[model samples]
Target: MVDQSHSFYLTSSLQQKLSKLVLAAFCLFTLYFWPQRFELWLIQVVIAVAICSYFSYTIYRLKSYKSSFTLHSRNLFKFANNPNEFECKVLWVSPLLCAFYVLPNTEVEDQAGKSQLIIVWRDMLSDSNFRHLSRLLLYIRRNQASG
Candidate 1:
């Protein structure tokens, strides 16, 4: 199904692929530095393995976060599985990539909105949807600037 101008869905495969790429890079880095120093190399390998395990676990936990998102008027957005809507503010923008991260419109802030960081990577979205979302995000930014 086609998403509206204000709505977009994230592809799980893309997310998983990106995560795998990162994990693979870490693995490759460790392998590339393989040395004959058994003691030191073992310690380095253990540390690298630990870091990769932690990162994989974090990604698994974040799987619970909603994958679908819709932008409502007045800078409000709600996740598909979530009913409540929260006001959002643009945290960063990349005109070239039509990508950005949004934060909750609140006084207190953390890593991201209650769950995950709202980052839309170019590859995560289709060209048309990305263009529409880019325009919508621009509109939201303008409202923020004017008010």
Candidate 2:
């Protein structure tokens, strides 16, 4: 069985649908504009490379930390709690505007006996941010005196 203390929430169906719509719009725009300019093509290629690098790094970091959570699930939880909470603080990492934030959500019970804390973000936090957030959560969890 999966570790209950490390469980991550799942994204809602509506949020998933909205994400697809936004992705479609972005792809349409890219397709329309990408072929028009040689300079734009170069810029787009550079941007694509940067984005890929970011994602690769993020994924590597996430794997190293063994994160069970995903961006979609985090966003869904955030939306359910307070849709406006992410208006200013969140940052999108994907072309489709997949967001990243440091917002808190409801504690969830995993298949195991322990409870899990949730942190929502677009992709994942930076290395420093991740460390800080983890430390903060550890402190909180310790003080809470409950798993």
Candidate 3:
């Protein structure tokens, strides 16, 4: 039985990071660049409050939970193929809608001969979130080949 455990890291490209920074700067520029727009200042205040509240909630939930909620794949081999199979499990911070997901090795094949065991975190949170997760999964698959 081959027991291989790996931590998949989601790495962003330099271009991606630069684009994010640019977008953030643009938002900040719009918010603070103009000092005379009283209405715009009020809107910016509301936006800041909303952003703070969201982060506070996310942090609180992360700290308060004993362990992350997990969801196992019904059919592990539906995504991969192997002669000897293993079981995969996903640890998630949120129930169904979140960006953070962790996959840990569970069990390797003993005497039973299986093809492949796969545990996948399906982030069907939203179109954009799901797209991000899908990209992560692709990276994991590519890294698995090299590792």
User: lDDT ranking from best to worst?
Assistant: 1, 2, 3
lDDT per residue for candidate 1 within 1-147, as digits (tens), equals: 122337788764455557566876767576666676867787877777877777677667656644788886567777777666666666666643443444554654543456335767666677787777777777778888989
RMSD of each: 5.7, 15.7, 14.4
Give me the overall lDDT of model 3.
Answer: 0.39
Estimated TM-score per prediction?
A: 0.62, 0.28, 0.31
**Backbone clash count, each prediction separately:** 0, 4, 1
Cα lDDT tens digits, model 2, 20-98, are: 4565456545655666777787777676666556555544444344333422212232233333222112332323223
Candidate 1: list runs displaced more than 4 Å.
1-5, 13-40, 54-66, 95-116
**Model 2 / residue 63 / CA error / Å:** 1.5
Candidate 3 lDDT by residue in tens digits, 1-147: 122222222222333334445655566566666666867778888876665565555444533322112122221222222243333323332333223223323454353443333222332133454444444444444445555
Best by TM-score: 1
- Ranked candidates, highest TM-score first: 1, 3, 2
Candidate 2: the clashing residue pairs are: 99-122, 100-121, 100-122, 101-121
Number of colliding residue pairs in model 3 = 1
TM-score-better candidate, 2 vs 3:
3
* Alpha-carbon shift of residue 92 in model 3 (angstroms): 16
